[model samples]
Target: MNISTIGIIGAGNLGTKIGLQAAISGYQVNMYDVNDKILARSLKSMEKLLVHLTRTQQLTGDEGKQSLERIFFTEYLNLALQDVDLISESVIEDLEIKTKVWQEIGEIAPAHTIFTTNTSYLLPSQFAEISGRPEKFCAFHFHDVFYSKVVDIMPHPGTSSEVITILEKLGRKLKQVPILVKKEHSGYIFNTLLIAWIDAAGRLVTGEIAEVEAIDKSWMINFGMTAGPFGILDNVGLDTAWHITSTKRNPASRAFAALLKSYLDQGKLGVKSGEGFYTYPKPSYKDPDFLK
Candidate 1:
């Protein structure tokens, strides 16, 4: 299928990035959220990203301007789905919420539109049937689109082979490296390793084995990485990390979830809210003295 226009069914961080990238790739984009406030935030985020792209020479000023011009932000589901060739759902990572959103999209989206989910850990089969078009649904999960450029094309048992091929092409169009997950697996590949690493970081903190900076410093200096597990969790959003971690049945996961909950209670949602394990725009992990 030739995809011309893309519909983004959520306007959160990842959704905003996807929508912006789609527009940059010369696809008309409709970004949908539940409220005007959320839509406004999504637009603002795109604008900020465009500025960074332009400043870094990744996108010319005119290209950035044109990308924004190609994007339409809306609160109405029907408006966003109207004439869209594909729908990428990036709603909250909750089964019930995702099912509910998919059902609504299945009701209103164009019959020919392909359906995909950007779920972090959830399987596509969990919502494929709920979407009312099992064969048309698959998981097209993207990590950080610009930095982490891998997109996972994971199909449920009912997904069509044609849809898989189309998504592979589309992923490359969006300048991503597409990897096909042969089977249904929670957390895909990178995230599977990531979760174990993050779990260890959480255990160290909650078990009082080490402090957050100490844990992060140990990993960053050892691996020559820009950010450690805690630093990454902050960028991923503490709430999102908490949501994923809270699902694990292990004692260490539960303890980490509780710690995340405390941060959430304080209204500190990591970089988005300007504070998490450390302050943002100047996180200590980014400091030269941090590893020292």
Candidate 2:
């Protein structure tokens, strides 16, 4: 089915980014969350970002205004689901919470609304049965900054070929480079590679092989890359990094986890909180001479 209106079932980092991009790309975006305060903050943040983009000449003033107008935020599930052709669920990553969110969407959303999840670890298969339309269920995962513009479309054995085709086209409409995942994989291609690389970088720091700045400078200069692992982690958010690394506790892993925990405890949860492995809005990595 052709998707024009999108129902985003969470207003957190990933969902807000997706909604913002969808709106900017001219889709009618309904972004829903259970918390009114959080939804307000997200909308406010989106507005700020639009003005920033306009100021930077990345978006025309009229275009940014229209994009903001296209997004509708709500706490009511039914309101968000109304007339939506596709529902992208971005609830908490816990299996139970996701299953509950999908189940509710399955019950209330339009029958024609195809379901997708932005889950990082859980498989689409795990939530398919609860979705009430297993054949129409798949993974439509986007990066933290949807403006990076790459999306992973993963279909399980039970998903209909038709659903996958619809999503691939929808991804393009959202201005994303859609990558079809041929099999069921936990992290898809981009995430699996990214998580490993970041984890290894953390290990280097925890093992005392290098300071965070030194390691970042080395990686950027050697690879001629824009951002290094710590900077990337800041964008990914420290809470997520801590959660991903918490399961391991070897000497190196323990040290890394503790460092992340300290940041989390202090509410310095990365780019969102203005601090992490580095401070943001102008981290040292962004300095022109840092790589030198």
Candidate 3:
């Protein structure tokens, strides 16, 4: 199905990026979150980003303004899901919460509407077992920067070819490159490979192979600024990196878990709580403070 009005369940970074990009692409976007405050904050953040894009010549004056007007933010789930042609779930990473939300979404959304999850670990089929529309469900993983033009489209055993085809088309419309995964699996393609590197990095950090600065600088020198792992982790939030790496550790997540515990104990959680592997000068999205 051609997705015109898209509903996004979470208004976090990924959700906000997708929603903003969808809006810019001339698709009506409705973003929903449990907290009204977050929804309001997300709207403000979207406007700020659009303004920045306009200044950078990345977006035309009319396009930026139109994109801002295309997004509808709300805390009401039913209203957001109603009449939406496609819904992308970007809520918390927990399966139980996702299942609960999808079950509710299944009951509200039209049967023909496509349901997609932005989960990195959970497969689309698992949600189908509990959610309402299995055949129409699939995985649409967006990178940290949705506008980067790269997306992973994963279809499970229950997903129909029709759904996959439609999602690929939708990805193109949003200016994203769609890479399909034939089967469902934890971490799909990108994250699985990324997690391996992340695991090795965590070990290096804990084992004192190199300080965080050296590890981060090495990647910057090789892959350029945005490609560094430690820098990326700092921007993504240490808590999030910890959550992703929690599944792998020297002692089955023990080493990483202990590191996370100690970091939290010291009250450093990266950009969010102010300090992490490195301290932040301000809460802005500048590169992670390398030395503190």
Best prediction by TM-score: 1
TM-score of structure candidate 3: 0.86
Worst 10 residues of 2 by lDDT: 142-151
RMSD for all candidates, in order, please.
2.5, 2.6, 3.5
The local lDDT score (0 to 100) that residue 230 gets in candidate 2 is: 91
Q: Which tens-of-lDDT digit does each residue in 188-209 have in candidate 1? A: 9998898899999999999999
Collision pairs in model 2: none
Model 2: CA > 4 A from native: 249-252, 262-268, 271-275, 279-284
Give the worst 10-residue stretch by lDDT in candidate 1.
241-250
What lDDT score belongs to each candidate, Candidate 1 first? 0.94, 0.88, 0.81
What residue pairs are clashing in model 3?
270-275
In order of appearance, the predictions have TM-scores of 0.87, 0.87, 0.86
**How far is 33's C-alpha from truth in model 2 (Å)?**
1.9
Best by lDDT: 1
Model 1, total clashes: 0
Give the RMSD in angstroms, all C-alphas superposed, for model 2. Answer: 2.6
Which clashing pairs does model 1 show? none
Provide the lDDT at 226 for model 3: 50
lDDT of 3 by residue, 1-292 (tens): 4678999999987899889989998999999999898988888888888888888888998998888788888888988987899999999889899999999999888777899999978889889867777888999989865446678899889888988999999988888989998888788887777767766777788886876667766766676565356656666677777776666536735686678768877888776777876667542223455322
